[model samples]
Target: MTQLTTDAARAVPTLSDEQWRGLLEVRATDPGAVARAYAARRRPDPLLSRKESLFLVAADHPARGALTASGDAMAMADRRSLLARMIAALENPEVDGILGSPDVVEELLLLGALEGKVVIGSMNRGGLDGATWTMDDRFTGYDADSISESGLEGGKMLLRIDDRDPSTAGTIEACAQAVTDLAERGLMAMVEPLPYHREDDGRLTLLKDSRSLARAITIASALGTTSSHTWLKMPACDDPDTVYASTTLPCVVLGGVPGPDPAADLHSWGRALVQPTVRGLVIGRALLYPPDGDVRSAVAAAAAVMRAAHPGAPAA
Candidate 1:
C-alpha cells in the first residue's frame, strides 16, 4: 500500500508502513478484532458538526460495483487508494460522519481512524451497477440488527424506483421494513429514494427532474410504519425548492457521478443547500477523486461550501 499523503501537511495524518502491515496481520490472523475495533471506536455525540449540518463522506459505492470517478473507469477499484482518500477526507473536522459498508467500515475501525465519527452502515447493495436485476436491490450488506449491534449511529439504504420494473415494488417493501426496524432501535434510517427511467437497452438512467424527485421524496418519507427515524437522501435537483417541498423530513443532498466541472457541481449544491429542509451533503466521488486529483483540497473546498451555507440548522 502506498503511503497516503496530501500537499497540506495538516490535512491528512501520515500513515506509515508499520500501520499497513498491522492491518494486514490483523486481517490474516485476528478476524474478530474488527468487532473489538467497532466496540472501541468513539462516536460523535452529535452526528452533525458545529455548523449544525451533516457532511458525510460516502464510501459505499464500491460495494455496489459503482467505482467510476471522473473519467476513470476504475478509480475506486484500488482499496488502498480508496481508503487513503477516505481517511484524508475524514481528517477534515468539518466532515461530520461517514456512510460505508461493513468491509470498508471495519477496515477504518481497525485503522483507528473512525474515532469521534458518526458511522452509518450502508445496506442493500445487491443491485450491482450494470446488472439486469438492478431494481430488485436486495439487502446484502448490513441489516438493521447488525448496524445496531456494531455500535453504528445509523444505517443507509438505496431505494431506486423504476416505474417500468416490477422489482421496484419488492425493494420498496424491503426498505420500508428496514425503516421500521431501525426506528425500533432508535437508529437513523437514511433512505435515498431515487426515481429512474429504463431504456429498451436495459440501461437505467436517473430522473432528477423536480416532479420525479419530489414524488420520490414523498414516497420515501412515507416508508415503513413510522417516519420518526427516517431521513431522506436526495439529489441537488435543478429546482430544489420544488423538490424539497414534497416532504418535511430532514434531507441531505447526495453527490452524483463526478461531472467534468467541479465548480458547476458546487454551484448546484449551493442552490440545493438553501432549501429549508435540506441539511447537508453526503458526497463521495466528487471529493475523493476530483478532476484535479487533490483529495485534501477537494475536501477543504467542500467544507467551505457547507460552512457558507445556512450553518444554523438543528444538529444531531
Candidate 2:
C-alpha cells in the first residue's frame, strides 16, 4: 500500500478514475487503512489560535438523507462529487476543520485531507430527513469513545424538538447523554438545537422565530451534567441578537438551505457574525454546492465575510 503524505499542496486531487481505483484498492485489500491513517494523522494542535474563531465545513447532511442544495434535490447524491467538493473547500487555508459522519470523516482521513485539521465527529444521524419518525434522532454515528480514540477534536449532535411529537423527549435525552459523555472525555460537545412544529399533514416544519429559537438555545445549553465544553450550532436567523441572547456558550452559524440570492445569505451571515457570542460558521451545502458551482469562490466569499466581521482579528 502506498503511504499518504500530509503535504497540503498534494493532499487531494480532482476526482478521477485513478483516484477512485486507488481508494477502492485500499478498501478491498487492507480494510485497516482507515484506522492506520487516523492513527498516523498529523493532528492540529491548540485547535484554535489566540481568540480566533472556528470555520468548519459540514458534510453530515447526506448521512441524514438530506442532500438538496440550492434547489437541486440530488445535488449531493453522488459520493465522488461530494468528496471532490469537500476536498476543494478544505484546500483553502481559511477552512479550520470539518464536521462529518463516521464514513465521510474516515474517507477524508484516508485521503490525507484531514491532516492538521480540527476533525469533528457527527453523533446523531438516525433521524432521516422527511421520515415519519424524524424526531427520534438516535446516536447512530460516532460516539464519544470513538471520537476520542480516533483523535477527533469534538462530537456534534443534532437536537430537533417538536412540540407535538413525543419522540422529541428521546432525542433530548440522547443529546444530553452525548454532551455529558463528550464533556467527560475532555472533548468539545457541539449541539445543534432547532425548534419545530408539526403541521396538519404530519410534516415537521422548523420555527425560525426569535422566541422559538431562543427557547431551543436555552434548553440545549442546560443539557448534560455541565456546559463547560459545550458549543452551540445554530441557524443565522433574522433576529440574531434576540435569538443569541439565550446563552453565552460559543455559537457557530449553520447555513441552512440556501436562499435564491447568495449575496443576501452572505449579508445575513455577516450580520450574525458580528454578534459577540456568534464565533464562526459551520456551513455545508451552501458553500459546497453553490449556485454557480464554484466551490472555491463560494468558500472564499464566506471566509471574507468572517474576516470582515472581525477586522484586525488573527485568523483561527
lDDT of each: 0.87, 0.88
Worst 10 residues of 2 by lDDT: 1-10
For residue 277, give model 2's deviation from the true position in Å. Answer: 0.7
Q: What local lDDT score does residue 162 receive in model 2, on the 0 to 100 scale?
A: 92
* Candidate 2: residue 78 lDDT (0-100): 76
> Where does the lowest 10-residue lDDT sum fall in candidate 1?
1-10
Predicted candidate 1 versus true structure: per-residue lDDT over 248-316, tens digit per residue: 889999998877888988888888888889888999989988765678888888777776787554332
| Per-residue lDDT value at 75 in model 1 | 74
Error in Å for residue 184 of model 2: 0.6
- Against the true structure, candidate 1 reaches a TM-score of 0.93
Evaluate model 1: give its lDDT. Answer: 0.87
